[model samples]
Target: MPVMPVDRRTLLKAGGALAAVTIAGCTDSPSGHASPSAPPGPDVAVAPDWAGFGRGLDGRLYRPGGSGYAAAHQLFNPRFDSVQPGGVVKAASIADIRESVLFARKNRLTCVPKAGGHSYVGASSIANGLMVDIGNLRSMSYANGVLTVGAGARLYDVHAFLDRYGRSLPTGTCPTVGVAGLALGGGMGVHTRAYGLTGDRIMSMQVVTADGVFRPCSPTQNADLFWALRGGGGGNLGIVTSFRLSTIPGGKLGLFILKWTQSQAAAVIRGWQRFAREAPTSSWANLHLDARSDGTIAVRAVGVSTTGSATAAAAQLESFIGIRASSRSFSQKSHLEAVRFLGGGTSSPRTGFTAGSDVLRGPMDASTISALVGAVKARAGAGMTASAILDPLGGQAAKVPTGGSAWPWRSSLGVIQWYVGLAAHPTAASYNSARSWITSGHRAVAKASAGGYVNYVEPGRAIQSYYASSFARLKTVKRKYDPANVFHTPYSIS
Candidate 1:
C-alpha cells in the first residue's frame, strides 16, 4: 500500500489519509504529557502487532513509491543516494517516538532516529531500515535564561529562538545541524573556548530507550544515562526527545576574516598552532587551509573575539599573523549573523565531500607542522577543494575530567579536521582519491594527536577512536538501557 509523505504542517488532518488503528503496549507518560523512568527490560513482545504501525502512528508515514518519499528520507550527502530506507515515519511528538519505537521493536525493523539528517556516514538514513524522522518535533523556548530544545530542532531554529531573547547557546556552525545530534556528539564552534562544548551546558534531557520507557535524565537522576547522553554520539543507546540547556550572552560579537597568500600558508599554520593554544578564552578561532583548483595553498582564519569590538578581534588576529595578511575583513555582528556566515547562509554548497577529525593534545613541533602542511598540499594538488582546519579547544573545556562526560576529548588543546571535497559526480578514481587523501592526512597527524571527533564520521573506523577509554563504560550503559539494541547505527555502541 503506497502512502504519501507529509511534513508536520499538513499531517493527519487530511481526511482518509491513513488507517486509524489504535496502538497498544505503550506505558503511560510519567508526567502529564510525557515524563520519567521505567525499569529496563526487553519486553517488546507485549507490543501490538507491527502491521498496524502506520495507522497507530500520530504523524505521517512514507513508503517507497509514495509522494515526497525520496525527499523525506534524503541524507545530507547525495553521494549516499544509492542507499534507501524501507520507510520513513515523520514523528510529530515524543508520544510518536514511543509508538515508532514499539512498532520497530515489535516488527523487528532496524529503525534509526533522524533529526537534521546531517550525519557524514549516512547513519541517519539506513538501507532497508525504518527512519524515525523527528525533524518536525522542533518546539523551543527560553525563560529566565534557560533554553529548552526539542531534539529535532535544527541549529538555525535554535539560534533564532534564543536570539529573540537576547541570548544564545554555544553550538556548531552548520545551521541545519540538529540540536540533539550536535550536543550528543560534543558540538564545537567559535564561542566554544569562551563558553564550552554545547553538550557541557545540557542540564537535563528526555530519552526513550529500547524498552519503550520514557525517562528524564540529569546529573542527579538516571545519572549514568544522563552522563552518556551529554557527549556520546546520537542513535547509540537510545533516542533523545528534548534537552534543557543553559544559555549565554546573545548580544553582538566581534568577527575577523584574515587571509594570506599561498607562500604564507606554512608560517600561518605554524603560528596559529602556537597562538591558539594559549590565546585568551575570550577568543575562539579556526584556521582554514584551502587548496585552490590550480593547486595553490591559501590560508584564511575566521573567528569571533567575544570582545564585541571589531578593532580588538583584528588586533588579536594580527598578533598571530605576525606576517601581513593579503587581506583582512572585520565586523561586529549579532551572534546569529556570525553563525549564518559560517553556515554559508541558507543555501550550502552541496558538492559531495567526506572528512575526518582528531583531537590535538598540545602544540605541534616544527616537524609535525611540516608533515601536516605536506598532507594538505598533496590533497590540493589533486585539483579538488581541500581544507585542513585547526580549531582551538581548551579553556573551560579542559577543567572537566576526561571521564566527567562521555566525550573523552576534554583534555585536548585543539582539533585537527582534515577534509577533501569531491566532484559532484565522482568516478572510482575520484572516490579513491578523496578517501586516500583524508586517510593519509589522518595518519600524518597520528603521532601529534589521538582520538577522533564523533561528528565527523568515517565509514570503517573503530568506536574506540571516538570514545577512547570511555567506550567500555558506554557499552555497559548500552547493555543496561538498550540490551536488545533497538536504536542502532553504524557507530552504535553495539
Candidate 2:
C-alpha cells in the first residue's frame, strides 16, 4: 500500500515535472512526396497559390515537401504526430500574423495558432488545416516594473530572461510550456499563492482577432476582450502576439520537499487541504500522490516559501499532518535556480501521456479519498502508471472578484490532475484502462468538485464545466469577437 524512502527520480516522473515533449513530426506521407491535400469543402473549389502566398509573407512558410515542415508541425504530445497541417507559417512579426489570418479567411481554411504546441488535446494542430507557428515571434523586454514578452516564449526562456533583471512572473513549472497557453488557461504554480496567477499580472496584450484586425487589450482598452483573455481558454478569441505583465522582484526563495508513506495518505491529504486553505499567502505547497510501476504509491509534498525559513514551513506542514515526513530536504535558492529545480531539473522535450483535471471546491471526504486511492492502486496493479497532483487555489488567487476574469475557479480549494503515462505505441487496452481510471476519479470527487480546469481539458466533457457560471458571458464575448467562429476548437466558448 505504501512505498518507503521514495527517491527524487520516481517523484519527478510521477508528478510530471519530467514530462518531456516528443518531436516525431508528421509521417503521413513518405519522404520526398508532396503533402496530401485536404478533401475539398462544399464552398471552396480552386486551390490557393501556395508559392504566391509564401512570397507576400515576411515569415517563411512550410509545405508538406518543404524543409522544416515536419518540425514546424510537431507538438508536445506524441499522440498528435499523425495530425499534420497542410501548411505551417513561422510568423516573424505582427504583420505576418495578420497576413496569415487574412489568408486563411480568404481561402476559408481552418487555421490554428501554435505558441509552444502543448495543447493537451492537440487543439493546437489541425488535420489538413493551416497551422500558424508563432515560435519566431519571441521578443522580451523589461521596463519599469512591467515585463513585455512575446506569446511564443517558453517558460524556461522567459524565466531565464527575467532572472537577468531580478524579476519573476507567476507561471507553470514546465519549462517547455508556452507563456500564451499557460497564462490564457489560468496558470497555477509555486508562485500562485504568493503572487496570484500569471494572468493577474497582465497589464495589456497585443492580439490579432478573427477579423485580422490588430487590437490592444487591457483594463482600459478593449476591456471586455481583456477580461476574457485572462482566463479564457486559448484558441477561442484570437492569437495573442505579446503580453505586458507586472513583475515581482526576484530573490532567494525557501524551498522544501517532503515525502510521506502512502499509509498516511488519508491524514496527509486531510491535513494538506486545511494547511493550503489556512497557510500564509507567502507559503505554498502541492500534494502529489504518484503511482509507481511496481504498484506502490509515492506520497510527497513540494513547495516554496516567499517569506521566512523553509525549515519552518516544513515543520508547520508536519503539525497539520499530525506526523513527521519520512524524509525531507530544505534549501534556499535564487529565483532561476528554484525555477529549474521545480521544473524537474531539465527542459528536454519528449511526450507520451493523457491527463485531465477536477477542481475541488473543498477538502474531500474520507470516502472520496479512499475511492481515489483505490482507483490509483487498481490502475497501477493493471500495469498502468498514474498520478494525482493537487495544487492549491486559495490565498490571493481567490481574492479576484467573480467578474474580474473568465476563470471561474477562484474559490476552488485546488485542482487535482489525473495523469497517465502512455507507451510509445499504446494499445487500445491501455487507453481503455486509462479512461476507466479517469472515470473513477471523476466519480470519486464528483461530490466535492466544482468543475474542471480548462488547461487540463479532456474529451467528452461538457464545455460548461471549465467556465461554470461564466460560460454564458464567454459565449457573448465569442459572438462579439468571432461571430464567424474562425478560432474554434472542440471546447471553445461557442
Candidate 3:
C-alpha cells in the first residue's frame, strides 16, 4: 500500500479532490458496519457448478452480477479496477478458505486471496479469476504475551484491540493495512528500530496451503514452512488464516517532527542518516522530502523515542544535523495517542497513486544525496505530488541471524520509497510522467540501493530484487508446496 511511505494527509495537502471509490472489505475501527453498495459490474460467465460451490461455503459468495460482486472485488488502489474477478468468496472460517482453495484447484481457476487489498501491484485481485476474500475473517485475541490475529485484521483494529490490554505490536503507520501482508513482507514502521520487523515477532501461524490442507506452523512444528512464512510475502506459499505474534508493553512514547526548507534538504539528508545510524534502538526517524502544492519541496524528519522526552530526541537530531530546524514540535504521547498522531488525517479507504522502493545498502554519499534531492525537485509540478521517504532499518531488525527468515535486507540501512499521488483522473501521459520520475529517482540511488522491499512491490521489477539470496530457498519451498503453480502472481515464486 506504500501506506507508510506516502502519507495520505500529505497527498491531500498537495491539493486535489481524490477520485473516490466506494471502499469494500476495509474499516477504520473494530466494530462492524454495513458498507455502501457499489454499482454492480457487468454479468460475467461462471463455471457450470458455481452455484453449488457457493452453497457449500460457510461464507457468502459473490459471483459477477450478484449484489456484492462490485464491492467484493474492490482493492485499496483503484488503479487496478479494470481487473475484475469473476467471483469472490468472502470466507467466514478456515473451512471456507479451504473449500475455496479446493474449488479453485478442481476448476483449474486462478485463485488469489484478498486481505487488506493493499498490494501495490494489485496481486490481491485477478482478472476473471476466483478471489478468496478473507476480509471477513477478522478475529483477534491476546493471551500470555502473544496476540493471535485473523489474517484479515487491519492495523487499526489490531491496535485498538491490543490497546485494551495495554499491549502493542510493531506495525506500519497506515491503519487500514492488513496484518497478514505487512508481517509476511517484513513489516517496517516507526517501531522497527526498537522491536524489529513485524515478521520477527511472529511465533506461529495457521495457513491453508494451495493443496487445501490446513497447517499449523511454528518453530517446533512445520518448522520449514514457519521460516518461509515470515517475510516470504503472502500469496506465495498459501492463504494465511491466522498469526500468533509476540507483543510489547504499551506505554508513552516521545514523538517529534522537525522541518527545514528545501534549501537544507541535502544537508538534512546527510545529517539524518548519521543521526539515525547512531541513535539508540529506542528511537526511530524517517526523512521525507515532499512536493508541496506550491511546486516546492519540503524537508522534514519525523520520529519516535520510546524511552525519553521528545524534546531531547529532537535536540539530539539537531546536534547531528548541525543546523536548526525551521520549525519543530515534540510531545510525549500514550501508545494509542501516538498511533493516532502518526496515522495522520485523511485515511481514505481508496487512493490513486503509484509507488516503488529501494532498500539502501548503506549510508549514501553527498553526491548521491544531491542527485536524489534534485530528482524530486525536478519532478515537482502542479498536477501530481511526489515524495521521497526513507525509513531506518538497522537496529534490532539487523540482529536477526542470517537465514532467520526470508527477509534479506535486515543488515541494510533502510527502505527508500519513491512515490507520486495522481490527480482525480490521470491521463496515460500523467501516469508516464509519474513513472518516469520514479525511474529517475531509482537511477539516482541505484548505486547505494541493493534491492526493493517486497511489500512495496512494483511491476516489471525482478522477483530476486525482493528476496535476494533467499530467492532460491523460497523457490524450493514454493515448488514443494505448490508444484502445480496454482498459487501464482506476476512475482510469485514459480
Candidate 4:
C-alpha cells in the first residue's frame, strides 16, 4: 500500500474540515533540466536529437533549456523530490508517441511515458533520460456502446466527456489519477463492487512496444500482451497510448457516510466483515479510520448502493452495526457526483504525501483491529494520521475466474489501503516507527490472506510474492512481451 501521512481529526468533526483541501497542483522542479543531464550510472550511449523528430510529429519539441520543459515534467505526486528529466516530448497524438519511441530506440535511451503523473512511486515520470508526456492526448470517442480514450486522459476528463452521453466506465475514485495506470493495474473504486475494475471494461489497447512498433492488443489480437496489460502493471510493457473501454448506462446511486468512535471500532469491524459477506452486489462499503490529537479514534463508513434506494440500503447496513448515525448525507446523484463524493471531493489538497496499500481476502480478527487502532492513536500526537480503508471486491471482479487476466487476486474479498501521512521532515526514528506500524499491519493481515494487489505494493516485499500463485504464469508472459526487460521498473516484472 502507498503510505502517505495525513493530518488527524475525529471522523465526525474531520469530515467538512478535511474536505476543503484542494488536490490539484504541479509537482515540478523550479529550474527545469532542459539539457541532457547525465544520469548517475556510467555513460553508455548518446541520446538522439528527438527535438527534430518531435517537431515533425507534433510541432512540440522540449529540449534541454526549452521553455516548455518545466511544465512537461510536473506530476501529481509531489513526494517525488527528484530533478526533471533530461528531455521531454509532449505528444499531441498517437503518431507523436510512435515517433518518440522510434527515436528513443535509435538512440538506445530509456524512455518513460507519463500521463497524469499521479504515480506515487515515480514510475510514470522518471528523473532522467527521454520522457514522453501524453497529457495533451485527451481525445474521447464513443460509438456502439464503447468509449475509446487516450491513455493520457484523467478520470475527471473521461467522466465529463461521457456525461453528455449519459454513460460511465469503471474507474478509480481519484479524479486526478491517470486512466492509463489505473486501468492497467486493475482499478478499484466506489463502483467496483457493481461494475468490476477499470481493466475489466477494456476492449483493446493501442501501445508502442519496446521495438518501436505500435499495435492494437485485445483478446483477438496480441492476446498475451493484452492479458499482461490488464494487471501486470504499467511501464513493464510498451507505452499504451489509448484504451477502448466498455461503457455502462449511467444512473443515480445512493451514497451514505456513517461514523463511530475508537471504543466501538472492534465491534464495527467485526460487524462490517459479516455485512460484506451478505451485502448485495449492488451495495459497496468501505471503513475509514482517522486519528485525533486527543488520542481518540474516529471510524467512518462510506458506502454506495447502485439500486438507488437509500432507505433499503441503510436498512441492510444497519442490520450489522447498531450505532445510529449522527449525520446522514444520502442522495441520488449522477455518476460524476458520486465520483466527486467518494473521491473525497475536489477540494482535497494535492500536497506530497506517502501512501501504502494492501489486499485482504479473509477475516481481520478483532484483536488485530484493536492493535492497529492503538498504534495509530499513539502516533496521532506526533502529527501522523492512519487510515484503514476496506473496499469490497466480490462483484464482477470475482466473477472473472482466476488466471483469466494478469490481475491474479480475483478471489479477494476486498482491498485494505493502510495509509499514514508525513507533514514535516521525516526523522529516522519517526520513519522507522511508521514503517514498522505499516509492516506489522501487513503481516497481521497477511496471516489471514497472502494475496496482495500489485497496485498497492509496500516496501521490501518481493514482486513475485505479491503475485502469489500467479507469479509463474506472469513470468512467462513477461518473458514473451518484455524479454530484454526494457520496460522494467521497481517491483514490476524483471
Candidate number achieving the greatest TM-score relative to the actual structure: 2
Candidate 4 vs. true structure, TM-score: 0.87
Pairs with backbone N, CA or C atoms under 3 Å apart (clashes), candidate 1: none
Candidate 2: deviation at residue 18, Å? 6.3
lDDT of 3 by residue, 1-494 (tens): 33233211222111123211111111110001112122233443654478898899899999888897888888776666656676899998999999888887776666788888777667777776778889887888889899999999887788889999999988876767788888888888778888888889998899999899999988887777888878788788999999989998888988777889889999898888887789888888888887765778878887788895777778888888899999887778888877666654325457666777888999999889999998888866553468788888888888873336988887798878877776534567877777788888899998899998887776557889988988999889889888877677666777
**Where in model 3 is the C-alpha error above 4 Å?**
1-48, 345-347, 381-384, 401-403
Q: What C-alpha lDDT does candidate 2 achieve relative to the native structure?
A: 0.74
Q: What is the TM-score of each candidate against the true structure?
A: 0.87, 0.91, 0.90, 0.87
| Candidate lDDT (C-alpha), each | 0.68, 0.74, 0.75, 0.64
**lDDT for each residue of candidate 1 in 402-447, tens digit (9 for 90 to 100):** 2258888777877776665555545667667666777777777878
**What lDDT tens digits, residue by residue, belong to model 4 across residues 391-417?**
667778776622257877777776666
lDDT of 2 by residue, 450-487 (tens): 98877776666788998898898899999999887777
- lDDT for predicted candidate 1 compared with the true structure: 0.68
Candidate 3: worst-modelled 10 consecutive residues by lDDT: 22-31
List, in order, the clash count of every candidate structure: 0, 5, 0, 28
**Predicted structure 4: clash tally:** 28
The top-ranked prediction according to lDDT is: 3
Q: Once superposed on the true structure, which residue ranges of model 1 sit more than 4 Å away at CA?
A: 1-51, 347-351, 401-403, 423-425
